[model samples]
Target: MTACDQARELQRIIDQQLISTMFQPIVDCQKGTVLGYEVLSRGPSDSPLHGAPALFQAGEQCKQVISLEQACLLEAGQSCIRHGVSHLVFVNVSPGLLLPKAFAEDRLQSLLATNGLKPENVVIELSERYPADNPEALKARLTALKKRGFRIAIDDLGTGYSGLKLWSEIQPDFVKIDRHFIRDVDRDLVKKEFVRSVINLCERLGCRLIAEGVETVAELTLLRSMGIHLIQGFLLGRPNPFPTAELSALDNPDPIGGGQATSDAGYLGRYIVPLAPTASLGEAWQVLQSSPSIFALPVVDNDRPLGLLHKWRVMEVFSSTYGRALNETKPVSSLTAYDALVVEHDESLEAVSQSLLEDDLHYLKQHFIVTRNGHYIGLGSTRSLLRMMTRSRVEQARHANPLTQLPGNVLIQQEAVHRLQQNNPFTCIYFDIDHFKPFNDLLGYSKGDEVILSLARQLCTVFNGDSEWVGHIGGDDFVVFSDRLEIRKRCEEVQQLFALEAATRYPEAIRQAGFITGEDRDGLPRQFPLVALSAGIVVADSRAFGSAADLAATAAVAKSKAKKAVSGIQIVSNIAALNEMSDDHKTTLLA
Candidate 1:
């Protein structure tokens, strides 16, 4: 059939029994489980417009919009029982389809009971494709539905016209992100950042976002990295004519990929672990330990995700300046907003890719929240981003050294100075790499050069991709310009990545040479058979120190104090950021 003919033919069928149901799963990016399925429609077989959307659009053109919607809803309600699908059934209703007669004439709840369900279990998704001709009438009809315990949702957020306006008029319980927004989100930085902004906006407006149309493992991970809670995509599960036993499978490893599949492909599948709004810092810390990769967790009540917790920041309060106050803290979200990304299942992948792209540029803390019909379900992240974030900053500091090819004193010092200058800040930072007269003596200048080179490469990749600047001071020392706010975090990151890389990159000769020549901190053989580096962080940032040399001298005091601290990153960030913090804050608030 011609496109025109096919379109007409499809409408005729949706008005009849040809409206078949297709289920897509919503996935949780955090626990990687399925939460539920969203029901979409399929047109008659052999029709050129077999997809539900096209079929419904055809109905509208033919003035049988109500008939098409009726068929789809009937199928959804009946299928809910035929398939024994106990999860919420999401059926799309165009804005043009909600007639005033819906309240007094139609008994939707009674129609639903014929399929063995309640109004609350059936989520009526309202599509924004049709402009609201009379918004008040629409509101009155929806208010009646609300009285009947029906949950309303706004479909295709970000793609629709005036999504915020519709949201205000309808006050939907959930908002499904358009499929176009979630497609191939893994590689794109701009789209993800944009979606993240939407997530933040939702927080202000009190709406939940469910990301839709996830296909690849990478895309799923990308959404999670950005703190998106709920998701739905082909990678999660696909709709089946009948209920599949695989929806609840938790321990099953996907044959296609080693990761576990919590749900069959396309139906809502995501694992959710709940957190209270007033949870203590100790509790948050425990959760952090349990899931190291997760930088934030959704704070929820019953089924609603209320806010978020910053995993890294919470830990900082205890060990840093707020040590005594750490235990007194409750729910990290009290201080930090758990703004989450939300999208719906059954969306086009192209849209998803765009959102992920935007997120890459949004903030340093990257994570995406996924939702189904605006209900909290999962999260998304870019794998590459997580790897970069978790990488050791200390080893990176070592590698940052400009002279020896490791991150040296200069870069480390700058970070320290930046910390002192931070507004909430207190002091200075000291950057140190170990004095290496012996390694040069034992391994010859060439091997020493190789060591420096490896460290340098690691450092470059760490700072170059994520932050603005890092400098190198000569030999075994590095400086990082940082605000006092997250000083040790910067240090710890360097330490972890440095230790890991040092183990991996060092030559076999260094591993087994058995020369008994290096400095020993505890008199025990070091894992790589060498002493570890020491860093002293003094929190001071002052432009009065005209040259890098002066900064080096100031760092020297902190470094001496760190000799006792030993083999760890220390931050004296309290001193530095007075000027820098004001500059940064002014720039940030103004922008």
Candidate 2:
């Protein structure tokens, strides 16, 4: 369409309120819950300005950005209420509109009232794309909005013309890192460091940071590891007019970083009274003075954590010449250590440990903030984390197989029981060597050890993943637990690879003949086939098994059947099938 035509269309959209608002979920990855929705406005579907870029471009051309934003705000609030969305609603506002004279406070209040929304429920998101001509006036107007209970956020933080200056002056309640920094963040060191710096800045400023435009699970996993829980992206959900308030039930619902197991670290947390970020250093000193044992105080704003304020740092500042007079009334946020480690209470101990080790050494002696769903819960010391980890490692080592270093029977049962409780479908594969006693006689015990190690390596190689586990069940038997549907194909690969490995252990004559002569248990000489793999697979979902013991017993039964089969592989959907089958019945074979 022509520029004039687009301008006319934009005018009509604003005048008639023809804007359609789509809600994109902003999820709290740690809690697996929706924190809120970001309202995305689009022009009418049939118009040339249907997409946001074209729509907003036309508004800029027509010099009606303020008017367009007002319409969008009103439409967003009404749509949110209509959809029964009571969660926090984030609405985008132009920086130009934040000027005191450009936008009226009563108009905003009236808009919220008409839509049944309170000031605290709405977050006015200002994009830094267009720098404010008069920042002092904009700050004054934003202060007024803050006084009225409305929260402020800076959108597309790094992509704007005015970057740190805007953040420093505004001290927004939330800051959204632009998508450029978030894309490929898992693989990009520079991007990771940049985001880490942004996180630190937000913590020091007592602002909540959000990562935008995350499209891959890798990106999500990495961001979660770095202490960013609030996520917005297509990976979670796309924008829709009627978006679901919650995420769909996933087999692996939580985004765990570093392939760490899910375990709550809440027990290590100690509740401490947090100081407001706006509180003065003098106020903090008094509190630190009263609590002699407390080393640091968390700086919080509206229940959201900013960072930790250490006592030594405060004393050093106060002890400086003329420090008391110059810095007594300054906000505690200025002295807060933004780099203090913050972890969700549900984070795995291993994941938290990895994060701690990766941080600077100074953090080793510092207290880390522990939060539940991004809200401050308490503080956890490094000493406590290390102590717990030491205990956990000792227990894990006790249950690990000595030779293969895989989980022993106790851990295997624990893993199976954990999967069963989650109610997610998983597969268990039982593997045993065929004619192993005869092979052991033909080859010395030393050679037999090599064969066993080969199989263990193959199983580990095949089943290595975040949701896959390998266990040594003693002797020549091994078991694998996997959530993958293609696990049978992997089992076949292991069988093929083991066949090659088995040939290496045999003499040339025996390898060529594909058989070895050895004394049987009765002392009679018999010819046994070359050592081969026998695998039995059980795919479990909601079947009623009494315990992990019963599951293992069923897998053992399947392995017995597989030993008699020509293809050397057997699969059953559940234990009922095996129980119903007679001794003469042939087991199900994988195609």
- Return the top candidate by lDDT: 2
Q: Kindly state the number of residue pairs that clash in model 1.
A: 169
- State model 1's lDDT: 0.58
lDDT of 2 by residue, 1-591 (tens): 887888888989999999999999988877889888899999999888899998888888889888888898888878888888888888888768767474578788777546578889889888877788887887788888889989888999888687688789867888999999999775443576689889989889999999999875557766886799899988788999976644542123222212223244654566777999889999999999998978899998887888999999999999999998889899999999888889887677877888888887554645888887798877878787887677666766787788887777767766776667557788989999998888888778888888888999999898888778888988898989889856777888999999999888888999889888888889998889998999999888646565565677678778888999998999977767547545544233210
- Residue 9 lDDT, candidate 2, scale 0-100: 89
For each candidate in turn, the TM-score is 0.43, 0.51
Q: Compared with the true structure, what per-residue lDDT tens digits does model 1 show for residues 33-148? A: 55567877787667666776677667767677777766777777887788787777677776666764643425566656564687878777787655777777777887788778
Measured by TM-score, the strongest candidate is 2
Q: Which ten residues in a row have the lowest lDDT in candidate 1?
A: 255-264
User: Candidate 2: where is the Cα deviation over 4 Å?
Assistant: 100-102, 245-591
- RMSD of each candidate relative to the true structure: 22.0, 15.1
